[model samples]
Target: MTTTHEISADCKACGSCVEICPNRILQKDAAGKVFFRPDRLWMCFRCGQCMSICPSRAVMIPGLSYETDFYPQPALDERAFDAFETLAANRRAGRSFQDRPVPRELLEKLVEVIALAPPSFPPVKTELTVVADPALMHRSLGLMIDLYDNLVKKMANPVARFFIRRQAGRETFITLNNHVIPLLKERLPDLKSGKEDTLTRRAPAMILFHSDRQSENYRTDIAIAMTYAILAAPALGLAGTIIDLIPPAVEKSPALRALFQIPAGSEVVGAVILGFPKRRFLRGIRRPLKSVTWL
Candidate 1:
């Protein structure tokens, strides 16, 4: 059927599409024209090479036919590319945020830009929990602290620790008990009485990403979208940091999960806290890649 391919009479058989075919699924007939063989129709991937390269715009794909669906983005020149590198290098894990909350309009615009970012083919979607309100985030952080406190008490007991180790594996439980729990406990007073103000590090906003249980590539999808989200933030004069500390606790405790507003039947896979940074970084130190094995 014509479901997967369509070429209007506007096609000039210029071979632009033919040259760009990644799968080589399209082949020439005796007329020196391009057509996908019937057997190879099953292999057709909607990568949109044909549509993108077609000079006449004769080629069409579902959901990509509209004029607004495609646009010409010029390649970054040397100066633009250098600016990109600089922004990337200077990207900081901003734990300390200014007391001012991110403007709702700015957050809305950021989300709008991220919505246009690509996901994998048949991409799994993620649900975002945006804690934009300073008051709301404060309340939620308090609740999260309470839930984590209860978990620490349970994990501290020798009998409880043994069962947890058995269930969550020894190294995992040990890390929770030895490292994560103690740190939270030390900060518990500051968290509880609101004295220290470093509980969630004074972030004015937090964005939590969660995936539905049914998606097979939940983590991958969440991570890819998260990369887009964090990258987009710095461009708007905002900053973001990937959050690993919260998800582990949220995954383990139902109350914590609920406190973070993780939807039922979905799990928090990735998260980030975002806000205006207190101070900008002038230069960034490099962390070189260690293991390189080129075949």
Candidate 2:
């Protein structure tokens, strides 16, 4: 296996790396120079705190390059918070989209912002498949509708319903039986006949977030990444809604999986559908959280 750390000769003996390392893998030698403890090297989650704090730029992780990986932090001001508040307050779930496709450049910008999402650990396991074409989005919505239709049929059978309940647990089973099934049944004919799209809303683009099943925090990471994408979309002349309807369909069908290029064992955690809003909201609605108890 390749080594994880490399301490160059330019070490200034500042002890900054030693103090900032989360795992305390860096230690000061007799001359007070920094050195990595080989035994605890595996504990380093590559959070990059040491490298980010090191004044001498002497520390480098194997997979990270100082020249390419590090960038100067932007200056922050009161306007930053004001801008964020405005964005958050103005946010709306865009279910209605214009009949125009999102440009490839804007999609690339979205991916760039996604890359900056804070990871739960050193390396982010979340993978994104960007479907930039409206035609592909339509096809994907069709696949999702098919899956929901099939699910409703299977759920009608007692034996299959029992098995589904056991596999999906009580909460999910209840959600599907009471909410999802009824909704899908109502829209199935319209969806099949291309009269409407209640799920994907015929968005110009979509992004699927998936990760390996063995990832430490795939769900949390994907959620955060998805939030980042949603928030960044408006600034790029785009708007979107986070949709959960597509992942199950994508996961079950090999054709859908192949179309999205999701790896065989990976789980598609979430999705975001993006496009220009057919209409814009003039005001914001305030929906507070259900509970906010102070400790």
Model 1 ranges with Cα > 4 A deviation:
1-4, 19-21, 116-118, 197-199, 252-261, 291-295
> Least lDDT summed over 10 consecutive residues: which range in candidate 2?
1-10
Q: TM per model?
A: 0.84, 0.93
Model 2 C-alpha lDDT per residue in residues 115-180, reported as the tens digit of each score? 999998869899999999788877777787778888889998999999999999999889988988
Provide the global lDDT of candidate 2 against the true structure.
0.87
Question: Each candidate: RMSD to true structure?
Answer: 3.0, 2.0
State residue 196's C-alpha deviation in candidate 2, in Å. Answer: 1.4
Per-residue CA lDDT of model 1 for 1-295, tens digit only, reads 2355766778788878777877776777799777766677566557777777888987766556638656775677779877877668767888878899999887887777656655554433777887788887777677677777877797868888778789988787778878888888898877888787555677888788887887777788778777877877888788988877767667777766766678788888877888999888877887889987899
- Counting clashing residue pairs in each candidate, in order, gives 0, 0
Give the winner by lDDT. 2
What's model 2's lDDT at 55? Answer: 86
